[model samples]
Target: MQKSILWVFIALLAVSCNQTTKKEGLTTEADKTEKIVTATINELLASPADYQDKEVAISGMVSHVCRHGGQKCFLVAEDGETQIRIVPGGEIDEFKVEMEGSTIAFKGIFRVLNAEQTEEHVEDHESKEHHDVEQSHSTAEKAEYFVEAIEFKDITP
Candidate 1:
């Protein structure tokens, strides 16, 4: 009986020490140590190649907000002509967010989609009505996406 109790305690200790490793998935540590960069949305969109696979610390006005299934909040930040997506998750804060021009600055992993493969250029003015401007949306995109919670940094022009 004494040996069995000792073995159970050893098993518990081993289980506590042996933490699982994730090759690809969401993790608490992943949310903690993400990289951060600071740049305007226009700069990011203008030369999407510059900040690719880099975390961004961005500040802009909140343009739009949409909650899909109440799990995550997706919003858009607009600076003149450029816009960036703001995706926030978890119990962030109990603050009201009025979009359509509210200043905000946040840090997250920034991803710029490939424009050449998915987007097309339009040069004709008349054809502009019927032409579909290219949109930067693609899979395998590494961008300014942050997991877990994000703090409300500050407002900017």
Candidate 2:
């Protein structure tokens, strides 16, 4: 009877070991592939080699959502070197609701550059300056989520 129990335990251990090996192999294969979606700031930064000097896509909450110049606003979060900038325009009310200390989600191409290429100029690693919503915005177009081909969606929970 003891021998049978020992055999069962050994079988279980072997099965678990095999599963672990399979999981490790899958993770190894994933390291060679490209990732597009980032759930958090840490995960995004973990793979900087893929977006050191390129554009990538990501989504996250608007940690620092503030409007500048009265009309334009930017969401600031740690996106692999403050490269995460998005100004949501569509669904204004919904977006506002999110900006009110709520969670928001944005889906846009990230320009993971050391410098940001603005509409007419390039700003490099600025310390996240926010504008006044009522004073900075004039046209509905300013509500856009991106400046030079960047955009986002509201993420509410």
Candidate 3:
């Protein structure tokens, strides 16, 4: 009986060691990947150039997702005023309309638009918005920040 008990203890110890080794391997791989800087919608908007072309992780509530194709979505900060446009990668394919209003954290590269690009984006966006809504948007309002999302998953509880 004592021998059996000793063997069981040894088995448990071996199993624990194996699990720890696996976890350590996963951590190493993750550490090797590029680090994601966390920022809010307001921070990104405050200085779009600072975060532009840099990989980052941002958290915000999904205010709107374009119905035209689901390629675009807008994330609104807690203030409910500031927003950043997100263009999901091919991996994402599309975003569901139901995702609107849900908070999510996503990894992506913040993109900056020059005056020319901004003007084009605004024009495209206006074509999709309601006539009344489009009339209210100023040139400044149309040229907000943008993000190219590589990965996204619901973070809301």
Q: Estimate every model's Cα lDDT from 0 to 1.
A: 0.49, 0.43, 0.77
* TM-score per model over all chains: 0.44, 0.36, 0.70
Per-residue lDDT of model 1, residues 1-157, tens digit only: 9999999999988776664333224456666777677777667666766777677766766544432322223334353544555555333542344543567666655554454533432222224452244333211112333222255554655
What residue pairs are clashing in model 3? none
By lDDT, the best candidate is: 3
Q: What is the C-alpha RMSD of each candidate to the true structure, in Å?
A: 10.3, 15.8, 10.4
Q: For model 2, how many clashes?
A: 18
Q: Which candidate would rank higher by TM-score, 2 or 3? A: 3
TM-score, predicted candidate 3 vs. hidden true structure: 0.70
- Compose the digit string of candidate 2's lDDT tens values, residues 1-157: 9999999999999999999999778757754774555444344445645444333455545444343422333444444223244443323322343364444555434333333333222221122332334321222123212422133445666
Tens-place lDDT digits, model 3, residues 40-77: 87788788788888888888888777777787777877
- Model 2: CA > 4 A from native: 1-39, 52-57, 69-84, 87-98, 115-151
The reply for model 1, stretches above 4 Å from the true place, is 1-35, 67-79, 89-100, 114-151, 154-157
Error of 1 at 43 (Å): 1.0
